[model samples]
Target: MNNYNTIVIGGGPAGLACAVKLHKNNVSCLIIEREQYLGGILKQCIHDGFGLQRFKEKLSGPEYAERFVNEVFELNIPFIVNAFVVSIEKKDGYTINVSTVEGIKTYTCENLVLATGCRERTSKQVEIHGSRPKGVYTAGAVQHLVNVDGVIPCKKCVILGSGDIGLIMARRLTLEGVKVEAVYEIMPNPSGLKRNIYQCLVDYDIPLYLSHTVKRTIGYPNLEAVEVMEVDEKLKPIEGTEKIIECDCLIVSVGLIPENELAGRIGVLSDARAKGARCDLDFETNVEHVYTCGNATHVNDLVDYVSESGEVVADAIRDRNDSERKLIDIEVKGRCAYLVPEMIDVNKKNNKRVMYFRSNKILKNATVTMKVDDKEILRRVYANLRPPEMERIVVDYPELSENSKVVFEIEEAK
Candidate 1:
């Protein structure tokens, strides 16, 4: 049995960032990753446009993740690669079961940080009714095939959903002599960042069909074509609007959901919208000292935010004391899709909150107001709002008592 002060489960941007921060703070921690190497999904994402916020310069995913991985190596942070955490039981502290090459091992830690990241939504999740064909691939898998494996998954493909991965793959496949028939989006608006829409889709002259979906896939041992159709507001296909597009492959990049099986093992509460653990301001989930960050908390558009969330969890763990936490729930309303950190721990000295939110529908000239006990704390304004682009803001407010209620509402500018 190996014991440590803290256990960080994951070695991607989030997990690596937490280990780096903990090492810098002279804290004893162990990083456990299931993969053979560190730098999770980033190792395969060869495209640029990462680290724009954190580094203030454009970098590839590998380059961005490399910075943190290097820091972990330089500090000689203790980590186990190819280590799968099989079980977690919270006793006096936490007893974690691991399955490594050396066989079963149990590790004990006072605190656990889950930066498990997220999993991409697949064809079945989107209900793509079709035979399991060889030509169907997820955007991430196709990216790995082309960038890392030196093989192209498809020569001519039709991409479903305009998320960043799908958008980037559209350009990548096109550049590799693959013809992208068009991008089909069920929602009225594209789900990816606006910049990707221009640089990846419009720049390549690839067509984008909004309020549309892949009605059916035509393939057998391989994908022959796909039936695209317009969808109504409820996202159901319209009658007689079906059209066939000949393509060898169909790439799906609908969305991502947080991976929280380990958290579930600990009986941690989850937020419905966030699709991950519901954490407080200190990044501490309802499971006491157990913390969560990165995409395991919520799917973030930028990897920079993922790294930041990890660092936040590191600080939270280091300063964790026996003080009682009094939490106040935050109310979301007025067309807001969802808000991270659903509640505030008013008992803690930390008052600065980094909030991330998105609107339920598109809004122009919108205003977001935050108040505690009907007392205004902060107000932010935006010229344009879209569901694809999440809004992040730092809000500092007066410390409150246990009964003080916090509310966040979005509204059109009067």
Candidate 2:
């Protein structure tokens, strides 16, 4: 049995950040990573844009990982590489049974941080009817091939899904001398960051077909062409709008789903909307002492946010001595998709609290009003807000009375 003060079940930015923060406070932790090396998906992402908020400088994915890896190494934090945690069971008094190499390993710890991250939704998940061709690959898979394995999947590519990965891949393939025919998005607006759309697609002269989708892929051994079509507001295909684009490869970047198998195995409560474990303000799950962060909690587009979440978990673990932690549930109704840390406990030591949430619809020049039992407590106006971009709001802790229910609502600003 491998015993530690805490166990972090991932080696990505979130996991590493949590380990580093815990280690700084003299808390011993073991980070178990399934990959041969640390960094997780960040290792395969070679493009820059990460670390802008975290480090105040733009860095490539690997570079960002290296910074955290070096920090962990400096702290002498031990990690198990190539060890997949199949299941986790809370034993007597918080010991975790982490199934890994050398059989079922048990770690006695006061806390467990889950940073398992997320997985890209594949073509199979979307059930896109098409020829099973060799040239079709997920944008992340192709990214791994080109950036990690140093192999380009194809010369001519038609990318489906204008999400961040697809947009970035479009630019990446173009830089590799590959002909990127076009990028198709089912939504009217590109599902990626506005900056990415401008820099990766528009600047690269790649055509972005919004409200469009790939109807069918045509090819045998490799991709040859894709039948693209426009869609109505309801996303139903519009007749007579089918157009074929000849390409040697098709890369799908549909979306990402939080990897929550381990979370489910432990019987942790999860929100179907977030598709991740439901966490409290301390990042703790329904199961006491088990905390979740990063993409494992929700798909965060920026690494900075992941690190921020790590810090939250670390703070909670460090401040567990506080017995006055009071549970406060945050309800998102009316135009809100969901909120992170579905619940929170106000720390009596501090009267300020931060909350993160995303809306179900895009709002331009709108105000977000937060209330407790129908009484307006806080309100903030923003120039623009989208569901894809997570937003943070702060509330006065003193305003939260005992048994008070808080609700968040979005309204157009005058």
* Per-residue C-alpha lDDT of model 2 across residues 13-93, encoded as one tens digit per residue: 999999999988777788989899999889988889899987999999999999999998898899988688876767854
Give the top-scoring candidate (TM-score): 1
Report every candidate's CA lDDT: 0.89, 0.84
The best candidate by lDDT is: 1
lDDT of 1 by residue, 1-414 (tens): 378889999999999999999888777999999999899889988889899999999999899989998888899999999999999999869999999999988899998999999999999888777777779888988998898889987778999999999999999999999999999999999999999999999999999999999978888989998998999999889999989999899999999889999899788988997888898887899888899989899888889989988998888888888888787778887978889888777778747778888887789999999988898888878899988888898888797888887889999766
Task: Give the distance in Å from residue 25's predicted Cα in candidate 1 to where it truly belongs.
Answer: 1.4
Of candidate 2, the 10-residue stretch with the lowest lDDT total is 346-355
Candidate 2's clash total is: 0
